[model samples]
Target: MPRPQKVRKILCPPAMSGFSPYGIPATDSEPIIMTFEEFESIKLVNYEKMPQEEAALLMQISRPTFTRIYNRALNIIGIAFVEARSIQIEGGNCEFEREWFRCTRCFKLIEGLENHSKCTDCPHFEKNELTRLNPDIKDRIA
Candidate 1:
């Protein structure tokens, strides 16, 4: 049996939701979906200029797994650049490493730390359990 996919940890959501090629009819082709994990891998390896092993550790992934993910990201990016295809980065098996939470009732991702740590969208927010904020979080940063 295949192992359950681990949720890759992302520091933050992408600033831009997606990218598309100009001068082409939107209906001419469908946008390719790049997983959010792939985007994070690209940011870690290329944008951050971090070593693969170190980046892997930060993402809580094995070095080999990180390499594979990095290679796939590069391939997809190459395809988009070469073909001028629209690139839509969306779904991935992932969890946020930053201050965010998925509300159980509404299944909405929300910023928890800065926003009072309760999901405003949830109907049963009074009952829904939130992930605890670190009391020493500020100290750790300093």
Candidate 2:
């Protein structure tokens, strides 16, 4: 049997769940699903200007694996851009360094529950308004 996939370590979840082309209703086409690890690869290598080897070390993966993930992310993004399709960011064999939450009202990412109260600046800030980005992995594994 093949070796089990390693769980990638991600700093945090993406600020937004997904993206869509302007003027086009997302219902026009099926959304492309991009895993969290793929998003992290793009963020580290492209957005942060991090080298592939360095990013691999940061994510605790081999350079070749990191390159594959980065290339896949680029290709998915390219297809989404060219085809006017929506891109959804979710689902990966990864664990976040810390718990993350997002305020649905203002769409602000809150790093931790302790800081949730600080999101009072959001017009509709409420305890219930916070959605946990990193649910317990055990629940998902089963």
Candidate 3:
């Protein structure tokens, strides 16, 4: 009779216009595995100038949860910069509720839940995940 827990969506940095991807240097120090959802919380509230309440509502989380996520994200950013460490985004308890489509061939489940016209294991299926409905964003999180 218990309600199912809600899955938080990863909030990405506001669509940056003309921004290029840059890789941070990795170090011997352990990399922090901040989830995409937490990262989005910081970007929305801090960078996008959204109020905590508004951001929380948008994220479908309580205000306190949003605040905690935002703070954790900020801390990760600060540590990465101050320590000159590479930051790897990974390992969150969240689940993807998006329409997940199973590959008819390989039985691979696509996170976006959409069929990309081919199985992920197929040789010709590589157009880079973003273009495909089921992107492996988490696997490539670096």
Number of the predicted model whose lDDT against the real structure is largest: 2
Candidate 1's C-alpha lDDT? Answer: 0.71
By summed lDDT, the worst window of 10 consecutive residues in model 3 runs over 12-21
For each candidate in the order shown, give its overall lDDT on alpha carbons: 0.71, 0.85, 0.57
Worst 10 residues of 2 by lDDT: 133-142
Error of 2 at 8 (Å): 0.9
Sort order, TM-score high to low: 2, 1, 3
Per-residue error at 98 for model 2, in Å? 1.0
**Collision count of model 3:** 4
TM values, all candidates: 0.68, 0.86, 0.56
* Clashing pairs for predicted structure model 2, backbone only: none
TM-score, prediction 2: 0.86
Which parts of model 2 have CA positions greater than 4 angstroms off? Answer: 116-118, 139-142
The deviation in Å at residue 13 for candidate 3 is 9.7
Q: Which residue pairs clash in candidate 1?
A: none
Residues 45-131, model 2: lDDT tens digits: 879999899999999989998888889999999999999999999878788888888787887889976786656668656788878
Pairs of colliding residues, candidate 3: 11-40, 99-113, 100-113, 101-113
